[model samples]
Target: MKRIKNGIISLILILLIFVSGIPAYALEARPQITKPDLPFISAHRVIKAEPVYRVLADDKLHWYTTSADEFNYWTGLKGINNDGIAAYISPVPLPYTVPMWNMVKNNAEQYFVTSEESRDYVIGKYGYCDCGIMGYVVALNDAAHGNAQLYQWYRGATDYVYPALAELYGLDDNKWDADHYYNTVVASISSYKYEGPQFRVWSDASTLQEIDVLSPKGGETLTGGSKVNIRWKTMIPGGNISLYYTLNPSEGWSVIDEDLENTGSYEWTVPNSAASKAIVEARWSYEGIDANCYDQSDQYFSIKLGVGTPINWALAFKPLAMKALLAPAAPSNLTAISNLLQLKPMLYWQDNSTNETGFVIERKSTGSYEKLAQVAADQTKYTDSSAEAGMTYSYRVKAVNNQLSSGYSNEVSKPVFKKPEIVIPQSEPGKAGQVNMVFTLDQRDYSVNGVTKTMDVSPVSLEGRTMLPIRFAADPIGAETVWNGTDRKVTVKLDKTTIELWIGAGIALVNGVSTPIDSENPAVNPIIMNDRTMLPMRFVAENLGCTVEWLPASKQINVNYPH
Candidate 1:
């Protein structure tokens, strides 16, 4: 009879809920929030010296005497999803800690203080009759104590979760009834603002790693040459800070003020140029850790020359047609094969222009010029099979695009040698201590002692000279290469000779004597391409007593050293 009566009571409760037209799922418990949405905790002050209390799973404000007890309550109650609470992972494991002082204005309002500047600002800005630090909460998080993060939330306030909750609760401008627990009465669902895990406190003292940007938060327009006060909240103390701004990331950052004292605010003069996209950044690096604690403007800002004035941009600056202003550069290092290995001699030249439609090849036999053939852009080698065997031919190439054409390259003359005069060197057997390396132009793969290897950057031709990366080209021949970044110079030591050349310098020092890197073309200098340093192969090989030969048929360079 007793069990039957208890079942009847439970059935009446369910019948009552259904009669009220309430959803069944509303009776379920709230789900757990495992991870925090924001990186760090945020601070909110409706008014100032009210002590912010940590609301535990019991739905009560608990202020512990010891930080260890506070941490114990936090970790113990963290897993319990009774209240909407979670922990955040800081970028740096051990963060700086400071004391949070509870300051009171009068017998009426209270203000909590973390920074001294903020403490003074409220005192001066707002009338505070009784201004004094009540007590300092330890905010240090280190290895000695168990690292625990402190979180803060506002009661009867809305910001992050305000919009969604306001609509659901039918809250107006002056109506906020949600408590710290934020639980529902009829339904089991609750909506509360997600104030980020505010303070990083693991030590006996209370402190935080939170730096908030205060002013120019986002979407603000200022006139050029106007003074604006940039403000931020600095939690970490005793370290220098740097301020920077940029139109865009691709344009790189420009320093506003570097290594300035952390004073929390700086007055800046807006730039004179007009820009639609501009951003500001505040970076702080503390001692004892390799971490950059920083923050950026929440949104991009705009800067105009004047307010409501339509300035003529055409009168301010002139524009030029890029294609018409610059023509394609002339091709260099023109070469034509002499030996009669095929039907016609082969012509090759280094392509010096990046923008070109095609190359126009001109041949002069006995008289003026005659059009030979036109090859596509980036083509370095061409076959002139139409040349008469007995007659000598002169070839020149010019790079041409739709809009402009480059000047003709250096003239190269090659006579079709008779078949009888052609000679091929006999293949000799390999020997120890003898090095033979072959590298093809515009190719990354090269062969050393019959073994193939790859290079980061390929060997290239510049100004009628074969250029190779000093390290790759010299290492195979038992040469030592060293780069001096300060002087922008490269040093190669082989046998008893030492060769040194500076980047963009025409002269190279050989055995304490200065000589032009390319005597034929004194303007030829070492250049950096694709982050690799390219040097004249012939100059280095000849100076090191190695035989250097260029084979046009395959566009290969052979460097041989005999021991």
Candidate 2:
């Protein structure tokens, strides 16, 4: 009886193993699995496969051995009906799919996957069992390989993957409760895409090297309607190039030409609109990517109105013709005068032409010409107060306009004159007021009280007495001297004193008292020379309350006036 019972236990264990190998639906009724109407899933029909496990709406997990037909039925039903029950293989792991579903539901309203083809491609590449985790892996691989098309497709599908899965699972929130899974997937893709240098080439046209504008740089004054050569340099060849202009750098870009080749230069006729602030932009493109290489002017330039004959608007299609303007004529009749009174040099010129902005006066020293001063257009004279006495200076003047300068005028040169030095001795107190007068020999130009006077006869020394014309010498000292032709005598009058003297006389009368002209030497007397009365300067000056001295080495005579 014991042997028979053991044989039955063994037989029962064999039957249990056989039942577990068969399809679960063949033995008992199974719960139906439903699908959700998500674009990522609906566009890509899940392939039928033998189910290895099952997930229920209530979070119940089950393992099953089912045929391909039963799995297909569940997959098709689950794709369209959100019954919250899914049957999938063990290859489609639940750990990743649950979290991915949660992410999609939270972000469904804000993000979307628009490309149906991309959804099918991703589903075909990575099985639809855990579609969310499959998409994440495909996106990372595409980004790492710099596959721009595939990367964009996967990025778009991200929005729909998790939310659609959450609907299929019949859960308001994600089963895995992952809050930032979507963002983490997106950030990882972006980081991996930018890791390689070639990523920019596939992703962004702006990241390509830019073209450089080589000519018509900022601040250039270009003539309107004139042909100008616009130049640029770029690494991208055999690409489409275009030119654009704007009055303001911020906006208003007008196309100059769009069918240009990237051959570095293009000839363009300037427009009629005169713009003081003009900017130009150059664009280069390869294939269909515009702005592949782009550059613009560093700053604003200027466009001036054209001159001369007007261009035909129909045939030429250019702005008004611009003629080059000439500068103002060179200033003429340039003259320099040495001012004896002010001890400076004055420069004068004639403005022979109009439209002159100013005149540039240059002075030539020993070697080179240096800019002296700038004067207004109407001004014709300049006073150089810094001129040094006894130095020669040459000067020239040029007329200037807004754009150019005329040739220099005829140069004029002159030497400045030096003035003589004078000295006066202080007088002592309690003594008769006396002054001394001295004059340099052969120096006819002299100034007294700021007025220049020329003497009829220069001063001379006669028998050791310095002599000068009585009228010329006495007038400066407030003494009046008169000549009598009939009497051949002269009279000198001062304050409370008078002097009378005849030509060729050794003696003279002072205050009606007869006294020798020179008490020390009788031979020294007053005479007439050069048709003027000559007198002993010392005697005459002393009689007029003055004193005198002679300097032989310098041929100068000293004069002192009493205080």
Candidate 3:
């Protein structure tokens, strides 16, 4: 029975072998499979360090790669790129890019295949078709992102045609076989092999961190000024686009720019911190990556996460530092003046800690702020004595570092007040220490838009028994003043404009035209008590087209143009 059972099992095994037929051994162990000792062939590449083939018969190029794993790394002759651009070894060497032929001149080696494999293709195995096809590739380049370099193999007057190539938009020159022409590079691989240890890689994850808000970026620092600065840095390979910002760098920085979805970087403010504090960062996610880091080429620092090392800033922000953006055009840095001085309300700003030139001393009137001055490359300080009395004026100073400025300084102002009390000893005859003379008053109502009233408060005459004479200041003619000269007539010439007055020879000459003196020309008397020329007050003012101002408390007079 045991022998019969064993016989049955053996018979089953034989039957199975016959039914399955000899199992085909298509695959071998990793080490057992013999690698084909094929000669290695390589060419200047647009994508992967791939294998490019020269049709041993006709040298026209086609997509060629030994393995599909490196497909993403390929772009040119081996890519089948939608752009149809490829690169080839140039036949003529170049010291630099000879754009005359629209070819990218990289300093790589060159070689050639048999004429039978290329230019001689039509009749020969490799002829015109191969040459033409290769020639077409020589002129192709990556227009997608403008990176891949394509090269054509040609030796003729064939013109190059660029597609959507803005950089080469004006490539018109084509020198035939000259040193200036961009010659197509080509060389057939005399030897070939399968390169082992091929490497295709992905990046490590990255991140950016939000740092701290800084102090005055060096300009005005007014309006709660630009004293508070924004700060941020990288943290992860993939960050939230919602983490970017522009105006407000301090408050909730999560709300990023809407355009962040459409663009790679967001706009941000820079303080004129002399580049010491000026920095901007971009944040985004790179999904599914390894062996990498996130950094901005235009910033001052960077952080590498792959290594457990605390970023020393040497490599973190090294290759990508934009130090120029930190020096901003000054905006709000200024000095507010609460104390008004008599000489002129001179504004003096705090010297810039950054010590920069090209400053602007802007002033705000009342509560309204506008560009008061646009002084460029200016040093500090400005005099503002032109302000009216009793008017509460506000002012602030600002400094500019490079093009960046700080916010306005705190506003400083004071009400310029004028006195109104008057003590007049009656205008009677025969008074002590009195002399008759012409007078004019300078009283203005700024609250009502600088409206002023002028009247003759004088009995200026030598025939009087001595009355008080009002006081006035040094002024040009055309105002109310007394002129008591012994001469019978007075002569005067108006300023350089279109006016001239001569009150001599018993006639008044106005602009070379003779006319009688108007009664209003001398509204006051002419009294010569002291050894001075005293005459009617209104004659001097009205003759020169001036407005009068009088202060009652001080009994002072002033004359001015219609400013």
RMSD of each: 31.5, 44.9, 32.9
Rank all candidate structures by their TM-score, best first, as comma-separated numbers. Answer: 1, 2, 3
lDDT of 2 by residue, 1-563 (tens): 99999999999999999988998678887778898533211011111111222222222211122234543454454333222212222111111111111012121211112234543332222111111211111123334321232111121111123323345545543322111111111235432222222110022211223477776777799987789999988743466677776654333455678648778999988875567667667766433224224677766678877865544332333221111133455765576655323358777775654567899999865999999899898788898777788788999999887766877888988676454333222332323544334477767754443345565347766677776776666765667777664344679898988988755456788898888887787667565443235677777777877666667898876666564
lDDT per residue as tens, model 1, 12-104: 999988877966677778888897434322222110111223333223222221223444454454322223322222222233334444433
Tell me the number of clashing residue pairs for each predicted model: 17, 20, 96
Tell me model 2's lDDT, rounded to 2 decimals: 0.52
- The C-alpha stretches of model 1 lying farther than 4 A from their native spots are 1-429
* TM-scores, one per candidate: 0.26, 0.24, 0.21
Give Cα distance to truth, residue 247, candidate 2, Å: 4.4
RMSD of 2: 44.9
Candidate 3 Cα lDDT to native? 0.30
Better candidate by TM-score, 1 or 2: 1
Question: Tens digit of lDDT per residue, candidate 3, span 260-359?
Answer: 3313333343222222212233322221111112122232221113323333332333322122222322332233232211324555543322334555
Q: Which structure among the candidates has the greatest lDDT? A: 1
